[model samples]
Target chain A: MSETLTIFTYDWVPKGPRGFVRDLRLRWAAEEAGLAYEIGAVPFEDRQPSHFAHQPFGQVPFLTEGDISIFESGACLLHLAKKSEILMPRTPRGEAETTEWVIAALNSIEMVSVPWWFLGLSGDHENGLSGWLDSRLAHVETVLGGREWLVEGRFTVADLLMADVLRIPQVRARGDRPASEAYIRRALARPAFEKARADQMAHFAAADAKRGEG
Target chain B: MSETLTIFTYDWVPKGPRGFVRDLRLRWAAEEAGLAYEIGAVPFEDRQPSHFAHQPFGQVPFLTEGDISIFESGACLLHLAKKSEILMPRTPRGEAETTEWVIAALNSIEMVSVPWWFLGLSGDHENGLSGWLDSRLAHVETVLGGREWLVEGRFTVADLLMADVLRIPQVRARGDRPASEAYIRRALARPAFEKARADQMAHFAAADAKRGEG
Candidate 1:
């Protein structure tokens, strides 16, 4: 436990583009878990090789703890949940349920919704969420149907990841779509999430100010 | 423990397709852990509803163990590996290391490779993994670098999932290339993988036969 967990990432908030929004999930998980960690900002070009060795997929948010390295934001978040206390609940099934929401956030909601955001951000959403995106979002809206959080009745890693995923510009742009709106608000309401988002924002702002000074 | 463990999956084989390959990984984990399980094949199209209820993401090969439902091929494989023996190493760092490989398989390899195969199956891969595909193949080939398996000193769930991800048709087609060819051979050498591949082939044959009959 002496070795600090070093997280490889690019600043994701306060206004910089980064890997999938799930990167913020890792940030939130770290904050929620109360485990102090280091973040390494890898430039877009470096996300591939030098970085790819740590992550074969060339995605961001790879975790390096001691000699143990992990990729996949889902994998990293859950690992931190098991090792730490904040983002996860206290039961086997509870953790498993958290994972379910994580998968839903990533594979279902994040996959399509994130793209929708990217499309809107890049003005390329014409090829909307189909082949699984449409129904997935509808299901997401329904799942949040009446709930404020994702599972077992409290905020957990699932909500962190889901909230981050839903925060995508396009997904949020769906404002007043009932489920979508409620889902986003539910996520943003959590104090832990708010802190995490704020932390991400500050990190980017500091980096930007540094760049400006440079 | 009295309740039946229902595995929502296609009557799948290991080597045939990606979905089935993943199912076989779960089965192998179950077998290694000495768990009794039943299988259900949700028609391909209906994977959405049946799987959505269980998966939320509406993808296939999820596990319903007693009341715990798990999805995300990597997560499902990891959960079974965790709940069982041998498949996942028990030591904290060991488990974390193995999990990293699982993450790599899903986030890195599975992300692109699986999609590459989908493009082929969906008939959208006319894009051919030529420039990008060739580059990634070479990269995987290299990181695979002199290492035989993805993680740990021996085979684990990481290997199982990585094997499946690496075995994607897109990657398989590249098997003729010196490095990729070598990688596939190393992967196929495992008895479990051999079982998995044969299973996949039979499933493919049956599907082709059914298609011909129609």
Candidate 2:
């Protein structure tokens, strides 16, 4: 189990998705935990069989550590959380609280927001999912209004993932949720998130240069 | 830490959601693991702050085990899995495989299917999410065609969650995916699922009878 931690993503994506790619979630977690990791890439234009083997949906941000390769950014984040108390507290109560919030960020929030955003892509921002998204976001705003972080009264990977899910520009602009807005601002302001975003931007930029040369 | 295991759900939901209520997921898991548990109810028409405290989105299917209270069926399943190797494998690799697929069920498949189903409730089955749902289901069809179970050649919590997600009538009827259909059929055929479904139906039916009497 001596292999370096590797996070996989597309070699290049269009400008629209550059900053929002989920690979940043893994990189941000690794940085927050001060863990050394490397980035691996698969062709974005033509996904290979190996990529599909690693990520069944042919999506990005699958992680490999020695013999174990795990997909789903949420699962990968939890895997990393197990390695560092910085990402998640070790106690049973703390861990359960964090795990529930992480799943909430994925199943409850993203499930609504991503589809709402997708439907809005057809220029119907007031689409079928608008009310559902607003309800979910309003619940989150209520939760955030009362707490600085999602778990244990402190920052955890739950905050990292929830903030990432909420920070999508379209979703951010959908309403005036000052608490959620402040939560996202606080999360993105972390040095780890900043470095992760910058590094991801640079990775895609280098891929663009390589594509030009080819 | 000496308390009994308990699952929480609405005391009554309309007949439309009786067997399909998410507490069925927890009930199914407990039945599968042969664990002793009790059912707890919250008022469906009048959700209390206590209910919201347990489930932020005011959703059903949160679980309490002794001192720990966990929400999100996905999180609760994972938590229950930790208690029994019957729900999830004990080995690290086996557990990780089960976990990733569980998250995939929640984040990947249900994320699309649920919203699609919700939009279709307005009589627009061919809404914006149709193609996306088809694509995701097609991937699952491919995977299920190649393997009977979702993880490690055995029944796990991943299959339980996935089967529940895919068992939505509208989503199931969308396309002629024989493999996925067979997979769901096989999962639902389990005695545990049958018992869980019957118990949930009885619970809600009893509530309906009580309402009628009042």
Best by DockQ: 2
lDDT of candidate 1 at residue B48, scale 0 to 100: 50
Candidate 2: tens digits of C-alpha lDDT, residues B1-214:
7679999999888888889999999999999999999999998899999999999889898988778999999999998898899999988788888999999999999999999999999899998999999999998998999999988899999999999999999999988999999999999999999999999998988887888932
Best by lDDT: 2
Supply the TM-score for candidate 1.
Answer: 0.80
Q: Candidate 1, after superposition: displacement of residue B47 in Å?
A: 6.9
Q: Write the per-residue lDDT of candidate 1 for residues A1-214, one digit (tens) a residue.
A: 5477887776433343632344667777777777788877666544546676776656677878876777778778878888765577777678777876776666556545543443345465554333445666666777787677877878888887787777766566653458767777777776667776676666666777877841
User: What is the DockQ for all candidates, taken in turn?
Assistant: 0.35, 0.85
Model 2 stretches astray by more than 4 angstroms: none
TM-score of each: 0.80, 0.98
lDDT of 1 by residue, B136-214 (tens): 6666777666676666667678777776666665567764456556666776676666655465455656755776631
Provide the TM-score of chain A alone for each candidate, in the order shown.
0.81, 0.98
Q: Which ten residues in a row have the lowest lDDT in candidate 1 chain A?
A: A12-21
